[model samples]
Target: MMVPEERRNADAERGEMPVVQGIPIGAPQGGMAMVAFTTLSPEEQVVLNYRLAVMCFAFLDFLTTLLNVLTAVMGTGYYWWELLLLIFLLGPLSGLLGAKHLHQSLTAVYVGFCVLKTIAQIVFAVYFFWLWHILFAFLQIWITKIVFTFCRCLSRIPLERRAQLLDLKEVELRMVYW
Candidate 1:
């Protein structure tokens, strides 16, 4: 077994940072930012993770609303392009507000529910809708399913194997849904 001094030395060698290495920046303004997770308190980390989850929930809602538009056009649901557009804009904005006001765990629950709803709705469309709808739903659900599976796998990882880039709390919060 490793001694306590050895463990502390190893951590110090690894830079003594939080296990979370921070999220990636897809834009060009990034350089070595991957090495940095904000020096925020645990509470701040939770808040940041909650915002990310809330944004994910918002995007899921927008995509679902867009699919509803497709269903309306396909004669399965009511047609309302105006409503879709309104939701496309309002959904994320409202989610942002809600994230700011609601408890993080509550927002996490909403995110989980949205994912389940999206999955169920797509499965329904695949069964009852046209070939094109089936194709669309299948592709969409496949990607979502893969992501869900990945999250579950990530959660199952031994703590030592988890990437320093990952925030375990963030993964744990999202895993509550799966």
Candidate 2:
């Protein structure tokens, strides 16, 4: 029912297509190319989200390490002193490395931290047997489970869905060697 002029005007207002040589560009040269130009891929978003999570975890690790050191310094018992030192050494080290490597590498430092925490929790369960220690053990297990679940879900996402979600575009021009 709408005339060509009206359709062109609507397209211009929406920024859906570029103006080409005074004629409204229909679609990009390729559908995939247009999509790539428009949206961030889902994988990119997931990577970014993972980076943010790592940063948050690193901050928490730093705080926890500091608290542990303070508790140890307060002479809370030799066991507490040793445990706190271990936490101080590993927690901040792994956290800092994970945060620093996030953009450049997909290291398993976070997973390693979780594994170390789990081992520590098991040790606490056997030696301390305190309610707080038990609670912390369970919490670490839960966090590990959740992280694994998220990774699994990300992997299960269909390629097409990922493309649509991520707005991935195919490579266009071939490179020419000089």
Give all TM-scores, in the order shown.
0.32, 0.46
Clashing pairs in 1: none
lDDT of 2 by residue, 1-178 (tens): 9876588678988998675421111244643223223334454455435644655665676688677676776666556436546544554455456444432222345556667778899789779999999998898787665444334444545546544432222222111110
Count of backbone clashes, every candidate in sequence:
0, 2
Model 1, stretches more than 4 Å misplaced? 1-46, 63-67, 70-94, 100-109, 112-116, 125-178
Evaluated at residue 87, the lDDT of candidate 2 is: 46
lDDT of candidate 1 over 1-178, digit per residue (tens): 8776577568877999335444432322353212223344443444444445555655676677777666556765555654554544454445444454433333434445446656766777867887776776665565445334333433343444333224544554554553
Tell me the whole-model lDDT of each prediction, alpha carbons only. Answer: 0.50, 0.54
Measured over all alpha carbons after superposition, the RMSD of each candidate to the real structure, in angstroms, is 12.4, 11.1
